[model samples]
Target: MQIDAHQHYWDPARGDYGWLTPDLAALYRRFGPADLAPLRERAGIARTVVVQAAPTVDETRYLLGLARDDDSIAGVVGWVPLLDREAPALIAELARDAKFKGVRPMLQDLPDDDWIANPALAPAIEALIAHELAFDALVFARHIDALQSFASRYPSLRIVVDHGAKPPIVEGPAGWQPWADRIAKLARLPHVHCKLSGLATEAAPRWTEATLRPYVDHLLASFGPDRLMWGSDWPVLNLNGDYLLWHSIATTLLDVLTDAQRDAIFGGNAAAFYRLEV
Candidate 1:
């Protein structure tokens, strides 16, 4: 079964998204399974992991409700205060819910960009490992080195790098080298994987396959087939392209690989990486 490994949902009524209010009007609208189904059906995506857009347990609970309402939501990667003193208890509580596949701390929002490398954060990573939960490292270019350090330190913890380091395809890869270098280093860690999503939004407004090839090729080469996954990064990816656009891009992009390699990138890797039985 094909899986759109990354996506999200939110209710404006629950709480206002500080990042979306006043501007970014198009993105400010709410998107639940009702918004996802037709797009997903057109994309031939059978399952998905609805990720958290905010940083709180309430977001996790909200996603859990979405998952329960929609069978296609195969898993969920929600947010929690990973650095909290009750990290273990919080994770334990979230663990009781099967749909809660993992937790993301929204590293970009943290005061210190290198929040992943903080020694105090090790307990959180350890707790995830113990709970058999995947940790989605939502990071930007500058945070790559610190992320690499965290991956190396906790080799047992499953870490999936979201958005291929969020490279600047608009800048034509000058900053990509260092990001690629870190991913190469990260690839050596058997527990690490890369998410092949959100790139269309990373490029110039009118970018085509040629413009994204360099970055896509780099990530495929760095992580290879065994560790790379296909994700839609829906709603967020709509910032640049829709689900159909991402599907077309991914299907065409993986055409050069063998069928098995293509299968892993499309869904096999996600099923294995996220431990989703489907």
Candidate 2:
């Protein structure tokens, strides 16, 4: 049961996607299950975790609604206002749905790197722990220190670092510093996991397998296969490369691992991390 750990389905008209503007013509329109169906089929992907593209409860609910009808969707990682006083109730409400697996706070867009570690978010964080829902940290290299502190503070909340903390692939080897070092520090936490996705879009426009190999090697060495998982980051991934191309590249990059290790990164780890039924 292969699972694409992270992906998204959104409509630009939804008004909640503040980041989706017309200038980014490649991904300014609507993208739904039907559009991903053929690609998933071709990649032999049986399930996917559709993550939140917008930071609204309405958009979360919209994705949940879509999940209700799409069996191919293994889980939905939606957004919730963690700082709001009413967040715990809202999280509890969302937790009622079997497909609502987790929440992402969109930390990457926030100005403060330490925003996620704020004490005021305790209530919502407690709710997530109580409900056994995961926390998807959509962060960059700069946020790793705060993320590490937060993970240490909680210790029990399941957290997955999206995009391997989104290393600066465009800068080549010169970009390796802080990101690689910080990611290694964060990986020391057993409860923390990471997604091997979004690197293609992070690289130069004409990225190749060789261009991304170093970062991939670092992640594999830091987290190992059991704590790492594969994700497409599709639709958004279309900006730099297609689903098949990324899949092919990931396949080639991970080909050196044993079959069991390869299987864990491609599917087993995500299933266990997300607690998916499959």
Candidate 3:
């Protein structure tokens, strides 16, 4: 069963996505199972993990509600006020739903790059560990060092670095080395996982298989297929390419690997990390 492990659905009228503004024309409209159905079908992605696009519990609940009705959504990586004193209680409340797989705090949008390292948020991380839910680190390279320390502090927390820590793809070869080095360090933590997603959007109009190959190569070598997973990051991915195109590019990158390795990166690893029933 193929899984596109990190995609999102949103409506503009909700007013929760402070980032989903009119400037992002490609993603300014509503996207739902209907919008994604054709893409997933074309890509042969049987299931998906609907991740949060807004940093609101209302949006999280909206995604979870969709997951409850839509079998195509295997689970959801929703959001919570991770630093709030009530975070553990909120996590416990969300955990009651079988489809609630994890939490992401929109770290990339935060003003403080070291926000994840705040001691006040320790209870929320512990709650995720206790509940067997994952932590999707929506971080950029600027947050890598703190992320490494944070991941080390909670050795048992199932943390997955979204978008290979969203490397500086626009900077080309000069950008790949530092992010790759940090990825290697993060991979050393047995509990940490990496996602081969969002690179297309990062590369934008100039994206090509060649432009992304080196980064893909680094991730494959550093995490190996066993510790990595594939995600479409759709809707937002429309900013650069579509789901089928990303799938084709990913396939081309993984063509060198053995079938089992490809299988793990594309589906098995995500299933294991999210503990999806499929």
- Per-model RMSD to reference: 1.3, 0.6, 1.0
Clash pairs, model 2 backbone? none
Model 3: what TM-score? Answer: 0.98
Q: TM-score for every candidate vs. truth?
A: 0.96, 0.99, 0.98
lDDT of 1 by residue, 1-278 (tens): 78899988887667835676747766777889989899888878899988888877887888898888889998999887877889888888888888888988888777888777678877777888999999998888788888878877888888998988788777775767666777777777788899998898888787787877878888888889888999988888877777887788778877889999988888898988778858
lDDT of 2 by residue, 186-278 (tens): 999999999999999899998999999999999999999899999999999999999999999999999999999988998999999999989
Distance from true location, Cα of 78 in model 3, Å: 0.5
Stretches of candidate 1 off by over 4 Å are none
lDDT of each: 0.83, 0.95, 0.91
Q: In model 2, which runs have C-alpha deviations exceeding 4 angstroms?
A: none
What lDDT tens digits, residue by residue, belong to model 3 across residues 1-278?
89998999999999988878899998899999988999888888899999998889999999999998999999999999988899999999999999999999889999999988899989999999999999999998878899999998999889999998998888877777778787888788888899999999788485899988998998888888898899999888888887888999999999999999999888999999999989
The deviation in Å at residue 119 for candidate 2 is 0.4
